[model samples]
Target: EKEKKEKKERKEITPEEIMKPYGVSVDNIDDDEVRVLTKENLYDTLLSLAAPVRQLRLDNSEKEDRESGRRVVIGMVGYPNVGKSSTINVLYGSKKVAVAATPGKTKHFQTLFIGEDIFLCDCPGLVFPSFISTKADMICNGLLPIDQMRDHRPPISLVCQRVSRESLEHVYNIAIPKPAPHLPPDTIPSPDDLLNSYARARGHMSVQGRPDESRAARIILKDFVNGKILSVVPPPILMNGLDAHGLQKLTKDFNLIGTKPAPIEDQDKEKKRKNRLLNQQRGQRQYTDEDEMDRMVRLDSVGHHQGGKRGGKNFVQNKNSNKPWLEMKRAQKAQKRAKKKR
Candidate 1:
């Protein structure tokens, strides 16, 4: 089946065959985009990649490595035609039975090997969103515009040229149907024209009676990126992370290694902070003035100064007398009653 598909692609006309490229390279992009590569391939590509992403997440409890204790999951990620599949294939060699480029090439996820120690996961390309900020979801189908790109955006023609490997004729070759009729000489169509023709041929009409080729081109590129239309899956990984200290590098690279792991006093400070927060939460903790405490002390002094005799009488009979007989007797009797009560 793969052989037949490759043969069919070989025979089909693509847009790259017609256009000429102004020398430039789009090789620096590393985003594994595919969903909204364009509106055309959005639905199919999303459907293709999503099933596998979910499956892998559920596959296992990625326990730490026995030797290095690092949880390792390495997947191939890159733009379409960046030799992603080829690289993976080179890694695994011929052991993994199924590897091929589907229509729009790499639409599905395939699990391959890393010699015998690791797992190599192959996924569909991610379609970067265009136009505006897109929700990371399936329904939008990666349908974003060039305006959403960071730094700069190329013209539509430029994007097509790059995507088709600097050949408009190549793209036209793939787009034109087999056994197509001869059109007039000098009626040679441009890349945009060919795209428009294909868009019209496929019936993508707008309310303004235009072909909407821009939409069509975006769709084509997006689909190819996602492997929704056709692409190749590369081989497996040769040297797993287990060999070159990949696991060691991952495990000990955290900010918490070899530094004596912060003192217990730091924890105590954290506890104090948390307690302060709790008190604040209950509206019970705040600064208090010494003036209130001083006032309370003053009140106790004044109470002592006003004698306990209720009538405001002093123990001494006269103002100057040290003591009076009756007063002394009453005080002693009152003290005795207080002791009895205690």
Candidate 2:
């Protein structure tokens, strides 16, 4: 009777109960010590992280006490375009390292100092082979530039998998258009459906009046990396993860765009209206073929193509996509090889 009662009281462990939350945890550092640094308390955070290292440096430099204090080097490491340079600039209070929205901008590591007490070693962003799951994930995380993407489908699909479609609609302020035949009321929008709606809303369409999937994908990926489309991953300990309803609630609570902003005054509204009109006028103005040709000539004269893509992406930027000269050289080599064989 006692054994039966105990057995009945015991709860069975479900598969969903076994998984932990996804996050970084350093064993050496106290939970209190690990913090998300912001622009406001960045210096303090840096100093705190470097405290032990700085102390060791000071102890070693004690013999040379007659000289100036030695600086402790803090190496900044992460995947490309993860904002290493931006963090350093914030710490140094200047544009000490070149910063851009794209990946692989910082080709080389740079050594910089802060107030003779802390030395910042900014390393070029690196992507680990093992950590990479898909190209779309990399692009969505800002490890790859959206413009250089040949295909946007995989990554957009990954986005839908990680985040709910309704959350995307909220972020982009768009609704999926009703199908000719109604889907179940509970049916969710597919990534393609979302992209089509997004493209239409953003006016990203092809010359043929079709929604440009590539352009829409790029825009969606950009918004995602910029934190407009956020995925609410519950910590492993948080109730075995959130369901669709729970996720929807979480998204609504955490989504910045979901919140309503205060009404703008008439003066501010008028200024915005004027700006909108100006932009419309500028966009409406069309250039003739001759004008375009002349503009291209002028741009070439100023060495516009010399630097390649923005943010020092000279290495990865393709200068000649067609590669006519390369193809000709390959053909000549092949001809010579065939003649020799004969």
How do the residues 86-118 of candidate 2 rate in per-residue lDDT, one tens digit apiece? 988987678888988788889887898886677
Best-performing candidate as measured by lDDT: 2
TM-scores, one per candidate:
0.23, 0.55
For model 1, give the 10-residue run with minimal summed lDDT: 15-24
Worst 10 residues of 2 by lDDT: 15-24
Query: Which lDDT values do the candidates have, in the order given?
Result: 0.41, 0.67
Evaluate model 1: give its TM-score: 0.23
lDDT of 1 at 33: 45
Error of 1 at 12 (Å): 30
